[model samples]
Target chain A: MGLDPVKEEQNAALHKMRKRVIESIGRNMDLYGISLSTGHLYGLLFFADKPMTLDEMGSEMKMSKTSMSTGVRTLLDLKMVNKVWEKGSRKDLYEVEYDWYQTFTDFFDIKWRKSVEANILVLRKSMDEIDKIANEYAEDPEMTDMLQKDKAKLRDAYAYYEWLDRLIDTFENGDIYKLVPKEPPAKE
Target chain B: MGLDPVKEEQNAALHKMRKRVIESIGRNMDLYGISLSTGHLYGLLFFADKPMTLDEMGSEMKMSKTSMSTGVRTLLDLKMVNKVWEKGSRKDLYEVEYDWYQTFTDFFDIKWRKSVEANILVLRKSMDEIDKIANEYAEDPEMTDMLQKDKAKLRDAYAYYEWLDRLIDTFENGDIYKLVPKEPPAKE
Candidate 1:
């Protein structure tokens, strides 16, 4: 049987819409520490009707199976995609997380939380070191004063991290949706 | 006059503390689309007592004055740093915005807002295109159903961006402080 013109037109229209949005996604992916190609791959999987195998993904993306595998691995690590078993299928199948809010939370929960924790660790250690120095120079008023100032700076930084930690918790626990609802409130 | 031993010790201690924090800043700069070296330069300026000239920044960073100029320009464009007039000094001096909250807001306001706006623009265009297709296929139930589904998906994505736009406004207008206070409330 030949292709139906009407079905082909519908597919073309949908593909065009997906392409535009995917282009934007690919561009913004760098903000989240993801590569452009990987972002596009995620977008492809996102609009797909079913889980896709690496071979299928490679074919769809026009990328080598090796590259598709690596991209899928990155997405899996970020919790942006999932591997699922398909009955009678020997190959692995992966599906994208369709919930954008969940994807946002998962991405930030992993990347931002790691950066925040690392910075806080350094801040805590440096503050302790400053306290030690201040104690050593307690007899010198000038040294004590300077060290105190440095300690205060570190303390301020620590406070910011503390706030960030709470914010990260909000994302991880879905409290962010309470603040910014997933759906907009009804018009008054 | 020879350097005072006590003063030297104090400076050494302060440098050690700044170095540790700067290292973390440098590492995390990639998240904000900044180069590691530029992040370190910003960190150096953050801890400096006064605005630094290109010559001073280059010497301090062990980088060429040309590279320092380029880095300073990037920071200036990001509003993370400012150029100030120094009486009797022909050399331009720059200082970092010391308020971490302000810096955070500024960075996100510029970067995230741009991404959010661009995505929304594309979304709007794509949704409009879907609408055109739906209108053309109004008599075809199967085509209408598919187009309507795609429109709903795009609408869902648009809602997320709308929420993000509000979140960005909160940051830009300093209302975020009302939600996540700059400094935690004083212990009861």
Candidate 2:
């Protein structure tokens, strides 16, 4: 079911090359404000093999001892990562959340909530502006007609956002899995 | 034909609401590292009705004249957005990237290229460590035997990344459209 000895050596080289690329994804996360550190990043990188120690990650990344400790803590809190307690080690170790599509919900929930809040602030202000225009144009015959149209339009839009905010709130409340269609469910 | 008055009012409200949301999105582009400006965003927003001046957006968002001048220039350079000079007047009017999905390739191209290069560096180093483990164990007959088996399984995975990277590249390059189903082309 596998390759011969000579073929196996070539396969090993390719596999190493693959892991290296996956680890490089670590660098991208940092640039993107993804909040992952080189240690936590590589700690998860080695998850494919076995767990690694705080001291081991420091040497590989050439980071200070204090930085590694804090960095690993940050990863655990975001739940973008996790701690793996090996059977034999007294020290703590970190790893990435392996199911990427699943783990991303934890991350997206934070971002989408912020955007929704910001948009709500914006919509509320627009509603007030429309009301102001309606008040100012109440007696101007032609402008009253135009202002009425704008006010009515703005009110409807506000209602939609009101509904959307409720839907997203439902998403944040731990039952998002029931709502969102999972990507590529189990294959036969 | 459209809906009844109550229904029509609802549709117009949704339209207005979307406009406000889009306007907020345009203003918040900077937070996401997107290049559009408030003037350009509002210019595009109001253009469906008529070309609006920087003054219109400044009045809406209560921004200074200087800010509008600067924001408009940045949007023009991105090419998905641009300015139109009105006859007999020097007012700068902006328009949206109506075919934005297509233009996203150009936008993402700029963002991804800069970011991907940085991420690859991190991944490469993480990968180098895995290689070290392979080389060290290569000398011991039993370790070599185990690595040979381990490496084969991982190489299959690495090939996947190479395939993914290449697949996305092809998807961006246009040939993918030939095989991919598309919505009916819209009339000009």
lDDT of each: 0.81, 0.52
Q: After superposition, which runs of candidate 2 have C-alpha atoms over 4 Å from their true positions? A: A1-24, A30-32, A35-48, A86-90, A121-125, A140-188, B1-31, B35-93, B96-188
CA shift at A100, candidate 1, in angstroms?
1.2
lDDT by residue (tens digit), candidate 1, A1-188: 00233574546766677788888978887877789999999877866667889998888788899999999999999998999888999999999887778888888788888999999999999999988877888898877776776677778888888888877787788776676677777899
Score candidate 1 by DockQ.
0.58
Clashing pairs in 1: none
Clash count for each candidate, listed in order shown: 0, 5
Candidates in order: C-alpha RMSD to true structure: 3.5, 10.7
Stretches > 4 Å off in candidate 1? A1-12, A139-142, A186-188, B1-13, B138-142, B185-188
- Among these predictions, the greatest DockQ belongs to 1
List native contact recovery per candidate, as a fraction of 1: 0.74, 0.16
Model 1, B68-100: lDDT tens digits are 999999998888899999899999989987677
Worst lDDT window (10 residues) for model 1 chain A? A1-10
